[model samples]
Target: MRSGKSKRVSGTGSGSRKGSGRGRRPGKTAGTSHHAAYNAGVAEGTSLNQSGGGRLSGHEAKLQMNERWTRRCMAKGASAGTAGKRIQESRAFAAGFAAALGQPDSAWQPVQLTRSAAAVVFAGPDANPASIRQLLRLPLEEIIVVQEGASEAQFAELKALPEIKILNPGEPLGADVWRAVGARVTRADIVLFADAAQLIEAEKLAQLLGAVQAGADVALVSYASRLGPFREWDDLMRVRAFVNWTLGRKELGVSSIGLLPHVWARSAMDAVGVKMLAVPPLAHVTAIQQRLRVQACPIAKRTANESGKSYQGLPPQASRKLTNESLQTVFGDHIEALRAAMKLKGARLAMPDNSRCRSAAGGAE
Candidate 1:
């Protein structure tokens, strides 16, 4: 009886030890282990970029490391899920660091367009079916269509296109919201952004891609516009240009780079915090503030009047609010101060004449 009891006790003890060891292995490896490495990478990258003023270069370095980390993990027989989680943690770190620095993720390395390339087409409810078809036909590895407000027919048409992936946010989240969504969903070297109404051609996409390949952090489509019937639209550009001038970027003016048919490095957008809104003006402001290399590729000649279908392609109130917001963001708090100062100066300069002094001097009193 004593011998049988001892055997049972020993067996139970051994099983408990084995189970405890198994649980500790995963806890140490998956939680504490990877976390330490990820934090180290973030701290090192953030410090290096901040010190050297090499934000863009630092971004490229982090991206390369992420790719390598994923590859090594996969080669070592790690599951795809494990590899992806590690990569995502590193990416999230980089993104947060970039935002804290008030800059876009600028890449010093030439973009590798072949392996990681995609497009995000932000289509409105009135998107033409033919245009959607044209966009899908582009020679892109992956295409994501974010439909803001679509009819059942529109959803059906988009769904039928096997080459494209569709995202319906159920309601209109604004252009910037959709743009950011597109950026997040795509893991491409260069992410092409376009509006459904923009009538972007395959060749145009190639041109934008070419600009990105040549080291432009973001490439925009530029066209000339004159002040006339579309006074409001012209005023928007004027405000943008004025803000740029105030920033001492006198040679730069607001352009269509944010309008659509634009391409940006994925790393750059990711670092910029992929926000709920990223208008063309805001995009320009961010790239400029980050000191990113921005290139403008001129489009085929066309009247500015022929460019937009609706007035500025936005509802009147939305147009006003977004325009104001973009201008305020670009100019900063100093703009309000400047306006107040001007008002004070004007009041002083236009002070009412001293009527009593005039009467006394003329001996009228």
Candidate 2:
């Protein structure tokens, strides 16, 4: 028999974990002007309340408003919901335009003076010498190839390209590759690290350098498939890449999408202390901890067909596994690491949208 008196529940069980619902909150609504305004504020680093007659100047207010709006759209996209998805996609479209405007006009004096950049490639004995030669052609002050005993034939082929240096580790593959690169990059302003199998498109290096001049300490290239052979695989890889990119932009406050023709400012790398590339493929967390301003630039025909059927060549599955492993590696200790980095760098880890980029441009060098 059941008792007539109802038993009292001890706790109100904390409301569903934040961001568990489908509807808007009291102040946050989708597609509304206020929502847009709030996002603009967030992006510009000012509060709505401070816009009208507060400490922020007119330019500051405008910048803040734009940034807030852009971030709102990005945040909405990163969140789960129909409205959120729409906001995210819309903002992404807008971001393209913002990126263009973000660049200073040719008439404007360059805000930052760019120094020579170095290209560092990590190759194995089986690496494609022809592809490596093609990469060496990119406009860079120097190119260094770190190989596990690069054959004399390969060295001779690479030597044909002026300003290219070949370094043999004569050791096992791993951290030593990165050390070789770090040592060779003493005089360079930036270092680009890519695999031997990857092929970079024209103007890719220039675009990366442009991003650095625009204030991004580290710029990575986004690639589209060259051959139709791996369209399905490439598509899948893109989805995963986008997801990872979105996560880093929204949740982690970092950029992690795109292929690894990673271009980094020498100062930034020195600040982080040069180390081997032991981190997983998606080095989002690692970069964040290093206080780097990472950006992703889309490139045409940046194709990398993994050599043979080896794990490196595998597409989406391999990417997913590597991403997971990266997350796990930093799950516990790295949270603090990221927080410290953010504080030190005063970094804001969010995907920049058109409005935000525009706002950034107003102050961009």
Candidate 3:
């Protein structure tokens, strides 16, 4: 029999978030609460990420921990195991996965990608297909692998699989270009873009997929760590912030479709037009103009994969270097977005009109 105090502690395992204490020795409080919660019949959500000494070993370690938690949750109560939610991607992406980990045996089941869903993965020359083993578990309708500068023999394992299509552009193409190509060909209502070299954990990926399945037009993996005081931000963050501000999406901060591990709805791609996807900032601006639902998932920065070494042919590099050399490259992309917006809605674009049309009163004309 669990006492009421101990039952309250179980909130950590059940995703209640009510028992966290910040009083003297916050670490002690959290540790005691986590242990007490586990003894009360459910594992804490933090267990998925916390390991020996609060360190992350890798994705494989987390998967093994999650599997154990699944079995234990089922043994406790089959009814509670089916608990799930369909909120916006932010909560749905974090709490949905964490809470479901305590209830269901099949954590991936709640986040199923429909037959109308597809995945576009761009593999570099040094990318290993084996890293995506868990992603193969999702019941996505189709998966298009766009490999760059890699031989057919490199992906032999996934080559013979049904529903898997590989495209070789004969030369190395950037990730955004691959995303544009995938958008042009895939005919699903929901689409996922991925890099073959990224070793994202299955749960983290599922939460992002879950968000899109819950009706988001775009599901971006939130790199919240990138945000802080404005004074400390780098040029990339500054450029993203500036573009987002001009687009009347100041609330978006640095989040953008240009970042990888994002999901999109086919309608969004069509609204922006397939060609615009090659320029993600413009595509994002177009989506906003089209009134699409763009959301950021709330997976913590700790969930980020920190172990992988950068591969030579990976194309995210092109995006990283686009403007770090000088602000000119980034300004070019933003200029195009502003130009596209003005073409549709006049010089004001979508920004609010606070002042009267001073341009109309100009006597110089």
For all candidates in order, the CA lDDT equals 0.48, 0.42, 0.54
Model 3, 73-159: lDDT tens per residue?
A: 355442211112221111222222333233222222224333255678877766667545545434355577887777567767557
Alpha-carbon deviation at 354 in model 1, angstroms: 33
Query: Pairs clashing in candidate 1?
Result: 56-106, 116-189, 258-280
The whole-model C-alpha lDDT of candidate 1 against the native structure comes to 0.48
Q: How many residue pairs clash in model 3? A: 1
> On residues 225-263, what C-alpha lDDT tens digit does candidate 2 reach at each position?
222344445333444344444335432212242245567
Q: Rank the candidates by TM-score, best first.
A: 3, 1, 2
Show the lowest summed lDDT stretch of 10 residues, model 3: 3-12
Off by over 4 Å in 1: 1-115, 225-233, 276-280, 300-365
> Which candidate number has the best lDDT?
3
